[model samples]
Target chain A: MSTTAIPTNTKWWNGGRSPFNASYGKVMMWYFLMSDAFTFGAFLISYATLRFSLNDWVDANHVFNAFPFFGHQDLPLAFVSLMTFILIFSSVTMVLAVHEGHKMNRKGVENYMILTILGGIAFLSCQAWEWTHLLTGEHFALTKSGAIEMLNTTVSHNPWGHRISGEVLTNALRHTSPDVLRSMILEHNHSATLASLKDLNANELISKIDLNEVYVGRSGPAAFGSYFFGITGFHGFHVFSGVVINIVMLAKTRLGHFEQRGHYEMIEKAGLYWHFVDLVWVFVFLCFYLI
Target chain B: MSDNVMTAAELHMPHDTSAGTGRIWKIFRLLSVITIIELALGFGLARHWYGEPELHHTAILFVKGTMCILSLAKAFYIVSVFMHLGDEIRNLMMTIVVPLCLFIWFITAFLWDGNSWKNLKNTNAGSKPDQTEQVVPAVIEKGAKE
Candidate 1:
């Protein structure tokens, strides 16, 4: 209890004490995060390895250019930057919650925990919209026969390929079938129904599509879609589980469970997991979206 | 012998309450600024504002390198401050930090092998064709039939 330093000669690690000078639960939580780090590290590294091996890959700018409600504005990285801010803000709220826990302020902890949960859900919602946009959105890709076809990005498919232009674009347009051309035109001129566009021949349909407006691309590296979905899906899964853990912790806090125990270490542990989720997103954002 | 049992006082040692909310908000601001800078660089690269024609590739690489370093800085703040790892004893911090060093070699070996594979494939094939060159056109041609 004295302010004076302990004797230098005293044995610091003579057993029967936490050599780390931390609680058992906290120590274990750190180790758990460490292992989880390795798991994510491996996934991201493999993704990089694949990326490096490929000569050409899908551009993040081309793929993630859509913004919700903005309607095909070509705002690259805009939505993802919003998602990153949501996660970061939620991380702030979480740290505030833990700070409140340190002060034994139950009301503060509850308020911040709710905010953090909302943040997590918002991030997940952004991710869902991104996946839906990628899967459902039609893109123009050059087929093997030099015809252009409309395609969506899938785990096995990557519609975002090298840009096709000039003579290649003209030739691909000529080879494209009437039906595919009709559908491709309908994508741009949505006022025309499939039935109305159905009557037009491939040549007329090609005329209907403004060559300047048509962004024709070929298939990119197949592994691009797989890694995008796989890594982000895995990260989204973690955020889902973290939100669940935070909810349980909130319920326990409201019920005065930690109050009874005289410590809110459970909240602290949950905060660790939440922060780890945010940490992983930083790398995920860097890998998938930025570099 | 007395240290064998963790005293109640030791288990729940008092924290410096006076450090206050100032530090938390400061860190929050720091993280936000870092992210904003990263986004700005990303936008610049995407818009082709940063790289000149001849030096474009290296310029883009420089921007990416800066972003990576910024991301690592953000990660450090989240771990150290938000998770309160900075306040923990050095021994505990070392336990967490030391194992992470393995990632350096892990990344290097994997990426080196991947690049080597690319070179091997290119050399064996006599010309390096994109992976999609072999499979996608054929698949699309078949799909067109359906």
Candidate 2:
């Protein structure tokens, strides 16, 4: 190939055109997402590593069984599936916003962006409820001294452990402190006054308590709660930031910034980020909630 | 100003808005279906409503594997269609994709090492004498005293 035979247009790296045939901003966005992927990948892989090394783990189904408005019903994986759909729907809206942006339809963009933002906020609210529930909702666990104690999941603690057999629970119940017994009885019978319940001896309280209502288990590995909070908290932070970005994008769109600039590429960039958040949730859902 | 300009290749790239929107919804439906299937499998296996009780362990592993594959499928659709990565130039796609292959090694190495560590801990360093119970030599003790 002589120099004269070479086509100038074919020299992609010759500096006047983009080798990727994409805007610099879009390329940078993709690179940022790629790096973000690695960050999440490392976190999730480390989670898997810890999980693989452990002899026992908290079953996700048991931990995530609660659903809003269902009280104490055992609806495993129900709430998270709803959250997943909310996120997926929001992703659809975001893509629609981008599509409308392509057509220069400001109204369509505004509507879809609003929907997308609402979806994000709704998902965040669900996460908040979930975190609060896990942190506050009490469960029975067998302590090291063979006493049954009421505890909730926190970053440092996990209450979803091996179920205490009926016999073990009966034995452990006798050894439990009066304070724990009162609380456990109160949990089962909300109508009873704390002072009255506290006045009752351990044996009397144990007699009043129904063994079937009591769900006692051994204390689970602490890492379960830590990983659960760490990874989900990180993902929630991403969703929060994505919402902030979308709000900024929405404001810019409303201000006609893109119109004046002659393109809606900024929205496209934001859409890429928003979609990436949804993409990460797919894996997060799989890793944390499903399996 | 140069950054805002579309290149020759980009100019030639198809912009089929109508078809594109249709495909987006199609992919959305596909994603939702896949998610639903994953959740069904997850819920069913978790509740012991599917598979034989004798194969419970294998059933869980199988379901987990299926969910992982389905999650990858969802990721692919999100990246390819929703993010418009499929429309990007081949070189661009390769740039984004090739580096992701590292995850295979990253996950395998970490998990393999983790499992090995578990084995090591469980087997007490593969048949070595219990370090805690090893007796200290009296000669060393005497030398330290001196």
- Give lDDT per model, in order: 0.82, 0.82
**Candidate 2 lDDT, B73-126, residue by residue in tens:** 999999998998887767789999999999999999998987876556545574
A1-291, model 1: which lDDT tens digit per residue? 112243556454777877776677778989999999999999999999987765556678778999989997889999999999999999999988887887888999999999999999999999999999999987889866577777788887788876677777889989988877776676678788887876677777888987776688887667888889999999999999999999999999999988877777788889999999999999999998888
Model 2 lDDT tens row, A155-249: 87788875666677789999998888887777778788887876678899999787887678777778888888999999999999999999999
**Which parts of model 1 are misplaced by more than 4 Å?**
A1-10, A188-196, B1-14, B49-55, B125-146
Best by DockQ: 1
Residue A242 lDDT in candidate 1:
98
* Model 2, global lDDT: 0.82
Determine the iRMS, in angstroms, of model 1: 6.5
Structure candidate 2, residue pairs in collision = none
lDDT tens readout by residue for model 1, B1-146: 77577743365433454457787799899999999999899888778833242447667778888999999999999998888888776678899999999998999899898787655654455354465356444333322110
Score chain B of candidate 2 by TM-score. Answer: 0.71
Model 2 ranges with Cα > 4 A deviation: A1-11, A188-196, B1-14, B18-20, B49-55, B126-146
Give each prediction's DockQ, rounded to 2 decimals.
0.38, 0.28
